[model samples]
Target: MGLLDELESEAQRRKSNDEDASVLKAARETAYRTVLEPAMADLLAYLKELAAKLTELQPKIAIRHSLAGYGDVVAYVEHEFDVREVRQPSSKEITVAFHAAVSSSECPSVQIEGGARVRAVSASFQRHRLGAPLAASKDASGEVVAATFKAKGRIPLTAVFSADAASGQLRLSFSNFDDFATAVKTVAPDQVNEELYDKIGRYLMREPTDLMREVLPENYRSQLRARVHHEEVKRRWESQIVSRQQEDIALLKREYGIGARFNRIGDAMGKLRGLVSRK
Candidate 1:
């Protein structure tokens, strides 16, 4: 067939495949929104509330990111708490500790241990308060400083949140534990941002394979197939060089006065020279 005819046939084949591919993509996205996304959003919202409550006790919390069977990112928080020290005149010193907690489960119930001295104190109480927003400030490194708090023991919390459509999956890596705790406490149960929830939900429900097929157009796929064919043709052409060299040697011996063996060598050298010059 002529080059034009061959190209027309290829185009026709791609057009047929393109229609089916578009239909399949549309169906998949519909199914994702109607079924998969709602389920994922419910699970994510529950996890967010649970993690927020748990982390509210201290200023810091750790959240590990996971999707389908893959682990993506790890986040940590550093918390800071106000410490009050009471020193009595009778050589007795008393230290009182307080931190915020969301619920009874989140209350810091352990006693302060270690070499930290505490003398005869009349009374001590642990008061849990609600976390509030911190004024904007810059850290020593010139980065925007977020709220943080100090507390005993290492507590890990897990939460799932997503990003915008263009940004993709957003795994929040909270370095300021205190800020996370404050966010949990300050964010009212009924006041959660619906837009944020939807964005995060969409991200969590996203499937990589589906996303790949969605982003790649039918024309791009056709181009990729053509490129693959071209590469295979190039490889096969290289494999036939040795036989072509032999054929050249026979022709040289029969037609010209050159030796058959020298013809093969000369043809091989010429091919190498062409390759080097092209590079």
Candidate 2:
């Protein structure tokens, strides 16, 4: 084609592409507004409630370790949760997440003065000493291995919540679960590391059912309780109806004339045999 014709064709192609792009952008925006935003709001509210609960409780784990060369050491490691709030990274996306052990100074940690081997050996006792006293002496003489459980420190835990704008599907993922386990292993001996890791994991996974009782708004909680009660009552009534129907069927079968005929026949036969023997 001529230069002028080619230029005009390219212009039209560009315009078409721009229109398609605009349509996609608008669709994404609508999805984000109608789907992602509402879902994220609920998630953010839940996270905030969880954060408030954790902050108030300030749940702590007691860790203690001992080595052949190094003496026994005890530490009180506390976990603090921090929510990142909602953030829109792109036009079609939103994210909500929380980080455990966000503050170092605020979180309780274990400070040991020993070499890598000594630290590893001592940390093996972490699970055993969980919830024990945190008092420790600072007079030990050895290399220092500080195992802090904070952001960018030992045992960092980050949970991310992501929602797809178009589908409204929510995904929850932990970023550092393996890292958390690895950090525990690094400071603990092989024999006890697994046990310690399992124990710590179980401890961390625990969440009180009533944690949101105080954090959620009163109206929301009342609504939730009412809904739960309604569901429970409905289930109980359904089960009772099924059981009653079954019992009724059984009783009817037992009292039916068919079964009575067999009993009557046996009784008559016995009476006739007794009369004959007397004669």
Candidate 2 residue pairs in backbone clash? none
Q: How accurate is candidate 2 locally (lDDT)?
A: 0.49
lDDT tens readout by residue for model 1, 1-279: 999999999999999999988886666455444433443455354545533544475434343322111112233443332222222221111121222223323322322221211110101111112222123245577653332222223333223222222211222322212233322111212223454445433322221222111345799999999999999999899879977999999887787664666899999999999999999
Off by over 4 Å in 1: 56-160, 163-279
**TM-score, cand. 2 vs. native:** 0.33
- Candidate 2 structure quality by residue, lDDT tens digits, 1-279: 999999999999999999998887677556656655565665566556655766687766433333233243333434456557545554222233333332234434455443564355345435322222133333356334443321112333555555544333444444434322312111111122233324433434442222112256799999999999999999999999999999999999978877799889999999999999999
The residue-level lDDT of candidate 1 at 24 comes to 68
Candidate 2 has its poorest 10 consecutive residues by lDDT at: 182-191
lDDT of each: 0.39, 0.49
Predicted structure 2: clash tally: 0
**For model 1, the run of ten residues with the poorest summed lDDT:** 117-126
Report how far off residue 253 is in candidate 1 (Å).
56
